[model samples]
Target: MRADAGAILRIDELTVSFRTDSGEVPAVRGVSFELAAGEALALVGESGSGKSTVALAALGLLGGTARVSGSIAIGDIAVVGAGERELQRVRGKLASMVFQEPATALDPLMRVGDQIAEVIRNHDDVSAAEAQARAVELLGHVGLPEPASRVRSFPFQLSGGQRQRVVIAMAIANRPKLLIADEPTTALDVTVQAEILDLLRRLAAENDMGVLLVTHNMGVVADFADRVAVMTDGRLVEEGPVDEVLLRPQHEYTRALLSAVPRLSVAERPAAAGAAGAAGPAAPAAPARERYVEASGVSVSFGRGVRAVHALRDVSLDVAAGETVGLVGESGSGKSTIARAVLGLIEPDSGSVRVFGEELRRARGRRLRQLRAGIGVVLQDPVASLDARLSVAECIAEPLLVHARGLGRAERRRRVAEALEAVRLPAAFMDRAPRELSGGQRQRVSLARALVLSPRLLVADEPTSALDVSVQRTVLDVITELQRELGFACIFVSHDLAVVQEFAQRVVVMRAGAVVETGPTAVTLSHPETEYTRRLLAAVPVPDPVVQRGRRLAAAGGAA
Candidate 1:
């Protein structure tokens, strides 16, 4: 493709390949595109579709094993065949890249301010104090609150949204002409996602920079990008204006993807709303049998004396068999603590926990192990949870090996295959290592591992949050199907109300380490009583136009 008049970045016939044991894996297949100055183009595709590879290749960030063949021009310089030194000269000064997971991209051990300042020092001979001041200003520009104080904190000390903002601060520290953001909003809550998108838009507009946004979220691309490119199986299948792509998609893959996204506009809700009138499902009746897990008057305090902070205060709840319960809260709301307590991984200072009507808080050794064996957990980030060295089959077989040792080798293999199939994974993946799979595939493997033992209860903490929309839908479907087939209960924990709405029959609203409200999903959502639950429901993504219209109509009605 030729440059569109005056283009900041242009690539013609770019192809990228990696040498694998099976053969050469063609990642990007002769893809050609152009990004004019101040233009925002979205690279939309599912996992393993080569969207990220294209972005990585443009900045000359591909691995040594990758073979590239094409012409890439950034500004007036050619980067396709540039030497390491030449590329380094162009990297931060000409174009910068911001990865999806800011926590992983930023140095956890270093203060965030130092990391951003280092970028400036790498390009310019600047004093540490000057670079530090510039870093603080950059952080402020990215919409982070208290940027000065936050700059001194480590990556772990900031929220996911704030961490992403810091990463943006680092990316734009050198004021590059082009910024490549790869799935910047993945795994964030809807409220935080909107804020981050807004920040990116403002930054790109203010700098007059070309932005290459790589994501699978149609909502984001439709609302933000000027143009869109659809990729499939390492090939660009469609390219056009964002509206044309979203409203009138030509490619079958794009159509399938658009159809998969769940919309809240016409979603089914419960017969009654919660106290706050937030849309939710009707509450289901609690099971009559003894509670499988119960916590009473739970309180957890951190630190000591003046520094002592109460993370959980008088939190109480119960989970019954054959039921799915949702724990809803924002980050650091102590929902994870609740999960940990149920798993016997944490002990509350002043509370009683009972499993199957037996005291579990005091249980130790054999009894604790037995209780834990009946429960399973799927964490938010699968890459961190999975063992990179183990093959997919080996990972799935671990739970079975622990309990059913008497089973023959063939039987164990057969069970592993069945578990994999349950999660809709291809059988060929059994031989592949965790590193070989994409983010979504690794999550499926985690689900397979958890389900192999046929546990009665599953603790899924944002299980599909890190995946693309297509992958999220598929993963949720697998979990629902497995739950129905095996008659296993689930404790769905997430900040995404939309996802939890689909999974749980009941919902529990948690804030500041306390259960503010609990009721049937339909009833509570349709009519949320607590202000926190209402805020959470309102924070869900509605188009800006729709929000404005709703406000206007409400104002008119109020006046009438």
Candidate 2:
């Protein structure tokens, strides 16, 4: 690829390899791209496809063990072989990075304001007070609430979306010529994801900064990127304008990727007979199906009187046998609280939780263990949930060893193998460690572990949040198939309305620790009664740029 004169960032024949104990592993193989001023170029692929490696190469952020070749130039600066001093001068001043997980990226000990100010002071010769003032202004500029008060807050005190805003504030503090955002919106909710994308677009336009977006979300690419580059196994197989690449892709891999994104239209919804009864507020009457798990008038509070936070307030929900109930809400909306309450992980201050007709809070030693055995849970982050040291077999058989005492080693191994097969993982994967598997494979192992107990109730909390679009579709299909075959009740919790609308028969919308709306998935999403629900629906970015622009314009008019 020829470098354009007007481009702010350009790469030619870039190759990167990591030195491992066995051998040198090639990650990026002669990939080339360019980003012009005020333009956005997206690198789209699954995990370990070398998209991130290329971005890291641009910033000269690769580690000592990495062997890099080819030319990477940010304007006149050479990045591939730049000295430490030269790289340091260019890093924050000429270019910046926004990482995926804000929780890990931001320092917990430092106040948000200080963190941003530190970045400013690192590159510019501004006084401490001046930098602090600029930090507060940046916070407000990024649309964070109460910039003055929030400036003193630590990362832990802020919500996921708020922390991401703070990270963006720090990244753009220097107004660099190039901005490299690596999966910046992967862990955020749909609404927050849209807001962050819009913020980046506006900031890039105002500063005429070039943006290199590394992501796996096709919808985000369609909405935000001017050009798209598709990567697979360290090679660039397809690259062109967004419409040409996404709508008329020539590569088979690109076509497969485009096919995997879940669509939210009514046509994709289940048949009317399978859908929950016509939309409206959930019927005051009880469901005829047998209730497998129930939480009534649950209330939970953290800390003392002055600092108390009401996480849940009189929230009531129930899951029937062989049914899937989706819990949808923004961060800190008490959706996870309901899951924890049903799991007996946290005791509610008021009201009761019942599982299999037995009160969870009152259940004692043996009874509690027996009750827990009947319930399975899949958390959002598979890596955190699975032990890194343990092999796949051990991870899956853990529940069996704990609950089923008489079950011998051979039986446990057989169960583990069966569970792995159930989730469409190879039996050979049992011997592999969690670290050796990909993100999608590890999540499959989590599902297998959750199912080894043959539980009657399953609670999956954002199981596909961090996965690529293709991987998410496969995982969701596996979950649906397993639920149908096993006949287990499920409480599916997620902020993605598209996935929820497809997977759940009924949907519950929560806000400020209260249930705002509940009804059939199709009805609730299509005709949201409350303004908050409408806002959330409007916030979802469709893959079609025209539709997204129209939605944004309609929302702006409504707000006006």
Candidate 3:
């Protein structure tokens, strides 16, 4: 391994395995690659591929159940057989890794400044004050809005995209030779994801570091990677330049993965209404039908007397039996508050909430349970929503078991199996724990659980926010298909206008807990009546080719 002029990191015949219940599971099978100074390489594969395992190996972060073989050289240092102490010394200086989940990776209790300062203090001989200054500088480098103010904030206070930027700042604090980003953009919206990828590229160029990007998105690979290595069942099946690999894949699995990517055609891209042809005026008012869920003069207030804070004010909306309505707004816009009120989790201070022509506030005990059971809710974070220790079957079956106790063991298993298949998971996976499944797979399982009871209404709160682009598409497709088949009313909530544009038929824009505007999705997106809506749409990052190419190079296995 050369340090000054050429290769920064070199892996020769690396093999990694884990101790599973069934026996030993070899995750990285004879993987080898060279990462040069200021280069990028992408490791791409499906959920079970060895991409993540290889990253852990590179960082010497593999746990007690894992074993490694062969040589991994980083800047003239052999990390393959290095002890814990030695690895720690090299970790921040030579190599750093940005994790998949920003929420879990960051410490919730610690202030953002302290975390970044800790990384600086550990790897470099810097005074506490100097380290703190470095932390602020790092945050600025990552494009945070206000580093000074944000430094005092906790992890929970920031958005998902903001937290990811914090993590990136920490990873690059010591200016490591190699930066391994494992699905760095998986949890972010497409627009935010693009920004993050661009930031990573600029950082890599500025620091003259190699980057190893691991992801499941073909569009990401095609757009960003300098070179791509395709993995299947822990084996490196194919390796080549990005264009050669994605546009003309030699491997069957690679081709399958490429083909699976959902692309929007020019026709599919919605045209500007007035620019093309003005949309026809709304039809003449007709006799109003009975609303399935309705809210009138809805207002919620907290505290007593002068201290009270109004969360929602004069909110009004309706969803027919088969209508899919979208609630779009920034954070703290009372979207979730309205949802809670409708679900009977909270009582509004004023106004009425009706479901099936019955008041939700008056509903109690069995009535509330029956109503809730019929209206399923899918939360943003699947891991938080589900019990990690439970098997898929148990998680899905718990609702059925509690509500419908008459069903015997066989019937329970049958229903559970049917639900699992409906979400496109194999029956064999039903026995596996949630930890074993990928983020997308776990989300599908959550959807399956929600759909098991044949609920008449579903409330999804940023359901696809924490998924890869490919996975997001799949989840959205499944939801749309099921919506058409079941004709169930739904309340789709998200900050991403692109996702909402794809899913929702009708759109409701909210701000500071008040409805800003309401109309068809096209009308709201294309001809936004309010300035807030225009700003929201304007903030969305278009898929730029230069940004994509930069991301691809940084993500690939640093093969420059």
Candidate 4:
């Protein structure tokens, strides 16, 4: 592909490969694209599909092991084989990048303002005071609350959404002609994701900067980008206008991706034939029905005095046998706190938590261990949760070894193999390390490990948050299938209402450590009674451009 006169960033037959022990592994195979000024082009693909590799190659950020054979031109600078000095001259000044995870992107020790100021000073000749002032202005531009005070706060002191805004502020500090945002909203809440997308749109328009957005979220591409590029297996399968690609996708992969996205409009609550129990304001347990886990009037707080943070307040919840309950809330809203309280990971300041009819706080010694063995937990980040040194088999067998010591080695191995098969992973994967597996596979291993103990209850906390739409759908299907076959109760914690609507029978909305709303999934999402619930439902971006435009317009009118 040839670069047009108006193009600010261009890639021509960009092929990238990495030399590994097994030999050359091609990441991007002859991919070509262009981003013109004042336009937004999104690279949509799953993990290891070369979307992020293309962006990194454009910025000359690839490591020494990488081999590039094509042309990448960011204005007058050639990026494919440029030296460090030449690449440095182009980086940050002409092009910048906003990474996926803001927590790791920002320096923990330094104040946010200084970090932005440093970026500005690196690319321009300015005094420290002038740079500091510009940093504050940029922070304000990104819609950070109390920019003056927030500027002085460290990254650890701010919320996840606030930290992401600070990262954006730094990326745009030098006013680069091209900005590459890689999965910027993947880990954020629906409301915060919408806010960040709006901020990027405004900034791109105001500065007339070209944006290359790399993400697996088709909803975001539909709502934000002018054009779309679909990649699969290191190849660009399709590229066209957003509406054409999303509404009338030609490629099978593209169509599959669109289909995998959980839609709130089409989702229905689970049938009541085997519905477990109501979530909020728990009633007396029926004699025939079994309550797997229950937390009543639970209150938890961190620190003391003026520094105290009330994580939970009189929050009551219960999960019935063989039922799935979704817990939805924004960050720091105590969704995870409630999960921890139920797992006996943390003690509540007041009230009680009972699992299988045994109070968690009161259970001790052998009784406590026995009670804990019946509960399984799956965390958000599988990579962080799984040990790198351990093979897949060892990771899955760990629970059995701890909880079921009487089981012999052959019995444990058989259970591990069974668990892997349950999650749709082959026995061959048992020998592989966690690093060798994909994000979705790692999550499946996490599920297998959680299920190996044959627990009566499962707590999956944002297990699919970081996965691609198609992979996320597969994982959710695995969970549902396993739950149906095993008859285990579940508490699914996530901020994604669409996924919750599809997966959970009962829905609980939490805000400021209090249960704002709770009801059957369909009724609660489609006909919310509270403003907060309405806002959350509205914040979710649809995969259709026309619908998203209407939603944005309605939101703006409401704000006005």
Candidate 5:
């Protein structure tokens, strides 16, 4: 149907292609949808399915080589071929976009309140002082704590959730008619994600704003959107209300996408043979296998005295050879800090971290180097972690040269090739630059580099959080396969509870720098002992519209 007077966003037969070196490549094809005022429409798909392209095209944000066809309208503004001046007027006034990564969306140097005020000042004929006050008001409106005090703080000072709130405040500073959110809560903690979704829902209702949510997360789509549009291979495969679409998907691609979503498989785990009357089953006893590393009462603090941040508080963790321990937590939950401690990167203020029976805090010089050489680190965002100047071969070989400098060039090349093969990548990728590959490919290269040294332990930090469900599955599969052959222990740190469930045999839940719960993945997630763990599990939105609706209804009833 064509957009009527009440429609806030309308797109008809919109097709977009880019002029790549390989010639015209279609990103979006014959997509049409209408979003009414105060209604949220989610465009859901995997990577390269053109969901983001559609959102960007609505604001004419595509680059120079992008060839656009058909039409896109935000309110009465024609966005298809609009001039920069017209686009600018429409940007903050008619429509605004909240990108996925809050860090890149915000200005690191300027105070967040000033940034919000700048957007307000740009569109409205208001004084700087007035705009600043409005920014503070926006901050409070977005549920940010102590808005008045935080207004003067730079983006760096705020937490991830706070930074996202600042971005939302800026997006709605002008009260735009349409809000385009592309993967707004990709890597956020479960509770933070729920808060952001509720905030967006509340803001939309209060301001009568329509939201165009672009994401691959089925759970987010289930919780936030009124309607769902599924895209595949640059085409609209399915479109319906959230209930109808997600509850009973009509398209196979939609079904696959929903199926690909990692869900919390909570089951009725029968109590142990002799422990029927206990409060709950205890964490599994330590196995008698080869223990690779053990962290005992590990406490870490940054800064000193009153201003100090306690990143880890007497946190203890252990991993045996051929084991994968998932470290799950929110931001500032000591998960990453503990992982770094395990890697010998951080000297703990108290307690001890012993890897291969050697104390990490005391290891120095050659000892430290030797210990580090046995530990491999894989961080999130391969694009930033990888060196742009180096080819895949060099990137993978650099570790070998650093640890085993006596190895001949031929042996180094063979090791790199074997690593690539283990990760199921072609040997030809060795000569390619980091930028010359896709997100998953870059990540594979990163994995190859981490395993090139054949380290006994791997600390993978949010390694698959940024990837699509399919790509994430592939990476996890590769890791599993390699772990079987290589027999390396892994400390996988992630805020992605679903992925933690999928990849790790054991789960360690952290909160406020303390380990709240530790047990098998199923036991910890399904029957968590701590209220914090229960809250964490409850905050996770399963990829089912019916279940989500029931949860919302139950929550509303409880609130009432």
Candidate 6:
């Protein structure tokens, strides 16, 4: 195959396989693509779909238990069979990668400036002071505030979005011919994600850099990529311009992926709109729900003096039984702080968190535990929250053992099996360890663990943020089914307004430890009264390329 004259990155028949315990498993099968200079291409698919494998293969990063074949080139440098010396010369100077998690990419021991400087020094012979100065300049270029002072801070000191910007600064420090970013915005809030994507796009255009973005988010793909390539299993199913693939997908797999994305409707939709028909009358009003929990003037602060951080200040919200309330905000906006207050995990400095009609502040020891027993919690990362040593049955049963000590072993097993069935998982998975399960399966186990006690309220914190689009839909469907089957009030805490639009009846928009806006989900999100809420909503990228393009033009015109 002939390489395009303007192409900065070129690939042909790239096949990658791993030597597993079972046998040789193909990860990428005869994949071929080209990325021209100053262009953005997205590789999208579910968890194990060859997209990430292809990215790693491009950088020759797949080393352990992996075999790679076929041609991979960056500019004039060959990557497929290059030696370590040759690969090193091509890596930082010609190509650089930005990983999904910024935390894993940066070193905690060293200052962020030093990290960027180290990369610069590797490619070019420069003085340490000069490199450090360049690092600060790069940070400022990436839109980080107080770049000079922030350069001295460690990765832990910076926020998630700031750390990502630092990583991007490092990737472009050497002015590489190609920049590969893999799920760069997966963990960010919608507004922050928009900023990061805008930064990447601007950097690519300004430097004429080729960006190969690997992500499962269709919205991000539409907003950032000029072209999109859909992968399934280990093969490319569809590849075309963003509009053709997203709006008019020819492949069944591509169509399914597009359909699975949760669409956020910004139009005024009645609560009972789904029931109205020409022949049938409107659906009956929902039954009146009792106020199960009320947080009155809740204020929570950590540390003291100048070091103290006010997480929640006079923030009050309530949830009725069988209703879902969303606590939506950006990072450091006190969303999780409010959730902990409801769970009786922390004591508020002032105000009261009443759960099941009992004030959490007044509740003590056995009473607090009793109140908490009625409230179940699901965290963001299942792998981190779950114990690797415990089997699925053991993980789910652990909660039951603590909450109901008198229950017999046989009864505990019965409850565990019941919870698993509710989440649509097979009984066979009960004996398997957490590592044996996929991401969606692990999250289901997390949900099952939360349900075993038959709680009246469930608090899920960014539960589906880490999942792929298709798997995210499946998990959400299970939640909807379970919520209907077991009528429990839900306090869903998330930065993703789109997910909130789908799951919650009411939404509370929080920022800087204060409640800026609150109303019905449809009305609040569709026509936000506050500018903060409107800004948050505007930052969310729709999956449609045509619509996204129009929004981009409108935003650009406004900026101009």
Query: Model 5 off-target regions past 4 Å?
Result: 1-6, 267-287
lDDT of each: 0.82, 0.89, 0.80, 0.90, 0.87, 0.89
TM-scores, all models, native as reference? 0.89, 0.95, 0.82, 0.95, 0.94, 0.95
What does candidate 1's lDDT look like per residue over 1-560, in tens digits? 22233588888899999998899989999899999878999999888899999999988999789999988888887877788988898888889988988878988899999999999999999999999999999888888888889889999888998998898888888889999999998767766776787788888888899999998776667656888998988899999987677778899998998887755441222213233445455455664854677889989888899998788899898888878899988777888888888877778888987766667777778787777778888999898898888888988888877777788888988988988888998788888999888888899999999998888889998887778788889899988998888878788898777677777888888888899999887677667777777656755543233332343344346449
**lDDT of candidate 2 over 1-560, digit per residue (tens):** 22335579989999999999999999999998888999999999998899999999999899999999999989778887778988888888889999999999999899999999999999999999999999999999999999999999999999888999999899889989999999999888888898899899999999999999999988788889999999999999999998888778899999998888876674222223123344545435545888998889999999889999999999999889998999998888999988999999889999899999999988999999999999998999999999998999999999998899899999999999999999999999999999999999999999999999999999999999899988999999999999999999999999888899889988999998999999878778876777677667766766655555566666577669
Clashes of each: 28, 0, 13, 0, 0, 0
RMSD of 3: 5.4
Cα-lDDT of candidate 5:
0.87
Query: Which regions of candidate 2 deviate over 4 angstroms?
Result: 1-5, 266-287
Q: After superposing candidate 6, which stretches have Cα over 4 Å from the reference?
A: 1-6, 267-287
Compared with the true structure, model 6 gives a TM-score of 0.95
* Local error of candidate 4 at residue 456 (angstroms): 0.7
- For residues 1-560, write the lDDT of model 3, one tens digit per residue: 23333478787788999998899988888988888878889998866778888888887889899989987878877776778888898888788899998999999999999999999999889898999888888889899988988988999989888999999999999889999999987767555776787798789899898999998766556556788888878888999877778767898887777665544221123323323234545634434554678999899988889988788999998988777889988767888889888888889999999987889988889888888788878899888888987888898888898677889988988998988888888888888888888889889999989988888888898998767566787888888888888878899988767677778878898988999989887666776677677545544433333434443444353336
Residue 46 lDDT in model 3? 69
For candidate 1, what is the TM-score? 0.89
TM-score of 2: 0.95
lDDT of candidate 4 over 137-256, digit per residue (tens): 999999997898888999999988899999999988988999999999999999899999999999999999999999988778878999999998899999999889988999999999
TM-score computed on alpha carbons, candidate 3: 0.82
Better of 4 and 5 by TM-score: 4
